[model samples]
Target chain A: MNEEENRPVRWNLDDNGVAELIMCDRERNNLFTDSFIDAFLGALSEIEKERPICLLISGLPDVFSGGADKETLLDLCDGKIVVKDLEISERLVAAPFPIVSAMQGHAVGGGLVIGLCSDVMVLARESRYGAVFMNLGFTPGMGTTELLPMAFGPFIASEMMLGGRMFRGSELAERGVPVNAIVPKADVYRRARRIALQIADKPVDSVYLLKYTLSSEKRKRLIDARRNEDLMHRITFPMPETRRRISEQYNE
Target chain B: MTKEEVIEVIKRNIVENLDDVEADSIDATKSMKEYGANSLDMIEVVSTSMRELNIKIPRSELAELGNIDELADKFMEYINKG
Candidate 1:
């Protein structure tokens, strides 16, 4: 089937002047795959064209995204697909309008990077957030290195990346990540939409310019992290240890 | 530097930066992907090439890159312009 008939991301311009891109890969916990990328790109194109005052990203209430799959990662190692083609981190960072993340579920793996890249984040107090890459015997990818330090402090970021720790949404807020709201799981999207509507009520140019002007620091960190993570991933993915880890996971 | 010499530098740098890469797989006309180069590897390769070759490539010019062939040509053009 063509992309439109089966796209995972659902897009709509709400009456409140906000553009909403909700992820609905119910079968996979919204795990990122090629189809997910295609759906996201298609949604991004629509958001760019419409230039809605602001954007909101939401997924299932239990899981923001399951993150990268091992099979696709093996594809990356095999030179079948470039991480650049995924473009989730860069696209979220460079989006012309303010992008808000309605994170109620766990933002694990690649989801963590995307969460930090967003302009504003309102996470559910009970939801989990983490960079669980190290536990899988590989370095994190998709710019988590740069972004974690920028969002969480360097100390926490390092522990999260190196030690594979998971934190509650309230913990991130306590760490000074400026969570716009820390509500219950069911309230995550409603609060995010309220915030998006507030942003949407502002002048479009004002919002875009504000995002561009202030996002430089975060963008720089993302670049540094994206490069370093990808480089380390290159070194680690081909190692026997990581390969064994992958095999172990498959047999499970 | 001659085009052949430049190509040689590119090949050496790729193999050095990426342990998985094989020297024999380096083709003058082929892109870095032929040697299993990813975006991250390519970034390091391009940076090393510029540093070793003493060339300054414009970011816009870098965006238009097609492959290693175009990259070498771009480096030569930058060198000639300098």
Candidate 2:
């Protein structure tokens, strides 16, 4: 393992050169608000120095995330969060290491897209995944529309997105989405760490290139979609019906 | 399609999407949004309606429509204006 770089992303560099990257913001459901995005980038920059062989991304046990914070979405509507999120997402996708997301609960909208950016995912058997931007009358900004169709195939991905269906690990794994193992929530990290350690033992260069290849197209398209999402959001935000609908939902 | 037909399509969508909502209760006059049809349910209804009827209602409009009455009114308004 390379020397630990100090950053807010809270990296724990084990003796084996395995970096466990736990997201620290409990507020905002750990959704990367603009500030968190900057802090996370700084942290990821620090982690890059050690060139850790593998990464384990874990979060709060119950809600992996509820998606982008309402405030962040508001910021996105105003063009504040989109650029920063795109930068961070690009860096995350380009990292020269295998990322394994340890998911234990519901991951919706942007949160699920970030999880998709990881190379391998280990999920709790009961965890739910969704493309839930539709709930807020918006499309996802993190490039989920393209990523899901590529990962899970068009039919199921369309159902998940257009239908706004939230699927469990069992259902997703059966559909060929690349989750490595489904374990009990209590053991999710344990299994993730075990997988990470195994990867860490491999030749670093081989693993890095393997991950880079898998992540390349998704990363490029994510940045492009970020811009597309920005344009679409701007067009949608000011419509009279959009405001009326939001007001109604808030009252409800 | 008349307003009733549009409402029927939306109702069929809600019934198909909700495992718990019984099919018999989806009266066109009742608001789907009012009877505990959360946002996910609304998405399904909107998507299904678009596919089945070849009519597109912005998901944003689903929020504004409130109940079945408001949605039907909007659909009728869109049709009549055309």
Best by lDDT: 1
lDDT of 1 by residue, A90-152 (tens): 888888888989987878888877778888888876567778887667888777877777777
Clashing pairs in 1: none
- Candidate 1 lDDT score at position A169: 66
CAPRI quality level assigned to candidate 2 from its DockQ score = incorrect
lDDT for A170 in candidate 1 is 56
**Per-candidate DockQ vs. reference:** 0.01, 0.06
Model 2, residue A240: displacement in angstroms? 3.9
Model 1 TM-score, 2 decimals: 0.70
- Predictions in order: lDDT: 0.76, 0.70
Off by over 4 Å in 1: A1-6, A79-81, A84-86, A173-177, A250-252, B1-82
lDDT of 2 by residue, B18-57 (tens): 5456766776666665555545446556666666765655
Return the lDDT, model 2, position A184. 68
Model 1 chain A: weakest 10-residue lDDT segment is: A243-252
lDDT of 2 by residue, A95-171 (tens): 88888888876677767766778877777655677886665676656677677776667898788887676766656
Count of backbone collisions in candidate 1: 0
